[model samples]
Target: MVSLSGSWLANGGGIWMLAAFYGATAAYGIHVGDRSSEVVESTRDVGDAAANFAGFKISTVNLSGQNHVSPGEILATAGVKPTSSLPFLDAEAARMRLEEMAWIKRATVQKFYPDRLDIQVVERQGYALWQKDGKINVIARDGTVIAPYSDDPRYVKLPIVVGEGAEAHVVEIVEALDLVPGVRDQVRAAIRVADRRWTLKLRNGIDVRLPETGLDGALASLAVFDRDKSLLSRDITVVDLRLADRVTVRLSDAAYEARQADLKARAKAKKGSNT
Candidate 1:
């Protein structure tokens, strides 16, 4: 009985050693096969071997969270197609192509096993239209120029700003406008000149010329005058607040004549009353 037990243990140990040897051989074979397949696939031209790729098959195309870009468009732009080989697929190239689109701010691409590609994208957030050099352009919140100028009516409500260095000074203008009461709402356009002075065109076609120096003071004074006197409602064409102390106004010719005549009539009535 002792001899029989020893023989059984030896047989079991031999079987285990054989199984481990076979498993190691199988793993090495797989590694070699993968390396050889990669070499052959890398040497082959994808464009020329289109018919060979047809056999692998694309099981899934996952573009679930895409908002700005169409899935079909994304696939076409990435040059990804049905039955594309996992080893030959270029995820970085696909991602770069999608990033070229104006609406897509960033894109990430990944490959899933068997036959699936995953794509994720972030779209640009359009903030406002920037006008410069007689052209209107769309700008993002970070002040990046998104698109070129166009006369499209969709952007008609955007404020028109002009003059040298307007693009760099846009944030400052927005800040300044916010400080002035009612000026931001009534402003149709803000023009910046080469000298860095600002001129604002109101919705009512009235121009407010800000001072090259002491602009904040001028804006404050204008705010006070408007609040107390409703100066904007008057028949004034232009308000020149360039000087420090005085506010000069350019009145329409008709209104100016009427005001002068009224003054003279008042004086005549006073003299007659005195007599």
Candidate 2:
């Protein structure tokens, strides 16, 4: 042991030694940088095993929020297999893949640690069939085209609309038809023409040509005429409701000739009876 304190040289030497100790302590750091690198390399090996699907299990798969798509189909789309490893699973990538499907509007994917995957889906709502280039396809209310020619039978009764801008105008046509009593039942299909006018093909094979303006009024008038005079029952081929005050009916050639002859004969008979 050294002599007691209060000696100038001893005090000066002790201060220098303390300063050297603090400097060494400051230089030393608690770092796992090398250890982290080794751990990452190990995880990489595990990821390779997972990619090869070796010694892994999918304990739980929770699927929800699906309406049109099945869980199996979703799994197939995600490219996920039961034996796939946790390190190799990409939940976000799987979600993106599932969202690409036609019926899937949105999707969410979550991973619960230790071996569970949770999948959620939002499905698109199909509204009408859009007829384009002579082929009919289903569409959403916002005019997004869904599947083509799906014989799903659930959409069998949905109204089919045709022509340019038909997808945008189909809703309006349906609404207008609602205003006319029995019109919806009688209408087989509605074709929106180039001039923005509509030609309704009736179930009886008759065509009701509506005017560009006042279409609802014309439809209502035709409905009333159909009910009272059985206009639809006649053998007329087309009913042109373009005129404001009067309806111009274009009957079949034979029916027109027969009507004219009957009218003339009735007039002659009435004149003779009065005389």
Candidate 3:
């Protein structure tokens, strides 16, 4: 006989149930023609009893695709120790906390009925080692810092970049080196010089100075020079390609001594011819 008519648009099982119960109790009070302030208290008790009877306590939490960070670490960061009832647990809040971790890129939290939670995490993958101020850290492709670098075999194959603001320019350097296939293997590290140009440290203790602008063209010319003259194999300490047109070479001590000797002998012969 209770007809308290109005729109009650509630969604989700828990929310709908709670709203419907409260609404039904209010309507029933009007039909009973008696003041029943105890309806609210009674409904709350029944709701608590139903939630407990449904086995809504969180007991098991399953995490998938979590490799770099252990579940214990996630649980600690999430601040969501189990034994919390599923009906009142804030899943999105827990997920936000998990995403705050550096290793975790994204996270999805799913509530399984009764007593379990399933969490799927996407961890960041390191693209290179960033060496700055003599310290190394692992960096992702998008230049996000993953962790401090140690000599891990898992990331041994990745390129190592050095100097200030090197992470931001890693992709540029790698792509330019890719264009110059001959120069890639000889390069041991790509170091940012004054945060402008790149100085590539070669495997044999030589440095190749690349210009700041028009890097692709410079690399192309270097690649051509390497192909024609085997320029990389020369006993040189530095190859300065910072200039627009010409390349300047700084020879190793042995190579410099040999060149000086040849020059001195040619000068002596020219003086004798003049006499």
- Candidate 1 vs. truth: CA RMSD? 13.9
Q: lDDT by residue for model 3 over 6-105, one digit each (tens)?
A: 2222223576555654554455445435545486435434443344334454556777888899878876676444334455445797899999898999
TM-score of each: 0.61, 0.65, 0.77
Comparison by TM-score, 1 against 2, better one: 2
User: In what order do the candidates fall by TM-score, top score first?
Assistant: 3, 2, 1
Model 2 RMSD vs true structure: 17.3
lDDT (Cα atoms) of all candidates against the true structure = 0.66, 0.72, 0.77
Q: Model 2 residue 248 lDDT? A: 82
Q: Which stretches of candidate 2 lie over 4 Å from their true place?
A: 1-58, 65-67, 79-96, 213-215, 243-246, 267-275
Worst 10 residues of 3 by lDDT: 1-10
lDDT of 2 by residue, 1-275 (tens): 11112211221334445454334333221122344656544544444333323322345678888767777788879756644444345678788999889888889988765456678888887777888798998877766777786778878877878888888877777778988758788888888888388898898888988888987788889889988998988899998998889998888999989999999999999999999
RMSD of each: 13.9, 17.3, 10.8
Off by over 4 Å in 1: 1-59, 64-68, 82-86, 132-135, 143-157, 163-165, 179-181, 211-221, 241-246, 262-275
